[model samples]
Target chain A: MSTIEDVTREFEQIIPSDTAAGQSVQERIIQMLEELRFEDRDVFGIRLAMEEALVNAIKHGNQMDPTKTVRIACQIGQQRVRIEIEDQGSGFHPEDLPDPTADENLERPCGRGIMLMRAFMTSITFNPTGNCVVMTKDRSEPEPETPAGESA
Target chain B: MSQGNRRLDLEEVNGVTVARFTDKKILDESNIQIIGNQLFSLVDDDHRQKVVLDFTNVEYLSSAALGKLITMDKKVKAAGAKLRLCSIRSDIKEVFKITRLDKLFNIFDNRDKALEGF
Candidate 1:
């Protein structure tokens, strides 16, 4: 298996606060993941996480202002990938986000993006102002099933 | 509707409306808005009593897409109609689970199962 030392490819781009531009950036990262032989499930998670983060930056962070822009940086290794996304806007506190999983909020249309990002990424952190987010995902192998009698 | 404007392939199966998403990725805001409108029209305009969302063709969906589904659910309930989802990819299913939306929506393994009592 490859290690962090195998990290090679990197990408950096500044795009308008438009989802089309965000999608292009996502495709480049996903293409790199595929080239590195990342597992399909891992690719799925990473793609989903990137989608959430980019949308948050483009739509929520920049409020889809054409004048605003989003900066994305990515580093891909054989074993892991890291991404940083920063938007031009007044940041909000990540901690203030309502728990989408909570009973009262489950049916709400928004507020689930951050939760999905945390679930799919190995690690996710936000800058103090919360306009910038950094997320990392280490390629993972699926866990083996517990034996019938030994199930926890 | 023009091909570009139609996001769902609607089929009526035994009085139930089976709406299949045509896009492989439902991520963009404009696309989600169009989809949400088409979906809402099922209840608001067409008055579908039983609706089944077939996701077999959807390989990717963003939180905005999920938001549309939640709003659709609300509309269905408001109209006293039924709503169910089927054929979601496993990874996408995990998205629902993480959001605890699996508990809120009636999800099935396939269209047959999703349509079973409806």
Candidate 2:
């Protein structure tokens, strides 16, 4: 039921502005992927999603304060895997958030995280607490690595 | 946590080449090649067993970036190296899981573990 028995696979993380923290976030995520035995593209898909969420949480939500922290969690269920990201800053007005897909926002430097989150994740929700967000994914495909007798 | 305005950084850490980017949503289809090609060059050697992509700076991911990772993995594998991720933010991680990518790449807690895992 748990992927991170050693505390590396499944757990929570707090990030500072230092990009080094970003590296840790990336490592933990990919580690979970390898543990779960996903397909190649599936791996990329997950990384892409995770990256966008973290960047926004750190850069925009916290405004790179380095004082504010971004919190993360990963868990595995029988049929699906779940993740949550929370920030210390006051949440943005969802209505005020720009639409990245709109033609006017197309060339904007940033604002695509929400768009990609909707496209890639099976489900995404903003918490009423305004401090938390949750996302989920299902495991139904073949894995990229097949141990000795397993078929692709 | 300081604002870099979501710029992607590429460099070497723990002797492993990494692409550090801050993206907020699904990437536009056009940006894929630029990011993918750059990341590919870093992890494109068989001896180079690891590539860490830090997402703490990003808020979202588009499928375009997803395709880039898959293709980049292809090139890295052909070269005999490995591709991985670290410190993923949760909201975006959900997208990957929904896409079945949660089961993909070798994700770790940090670069040290990622490098040590190999």
Top-DockQ candidate index: 1
* lDDT per residue as tens, model 1, A1-152: 12245668987899999999998999999898888888878888899999999998988899999999999988888778889999998998989988888899988899988888899989899989999989989988856667899843
lDDT score, candidate 1, position A21: 92
Top-scoring candidate (lDDT): 1
For residue A113, give model 1's deviation from the true position in Å: 0.4
Estimate the overall C-alpha local distance difference test score of candidate 1. Answer: 0.90
TM-score of chain B of each: 0.96, 0.75
* Interface Cα RMSD, each model: 0.7, 9.6
What lDDT does the true structure give each of the candidates? 0.90, 0.63
Candidate 1: regions farther than 4 A off: A1-4, A142-152
Candidate 1 chain A TM-score vs. reference chain A: 0.89
Model 2 scores a C-alpha lDDT of: 0.63
Local accuracy of candidate 1 as per-residue lDDT tens digits, B11-107: 9999999999999999888889998999999999899999999999999888899999999999999999999999998889998888889999999
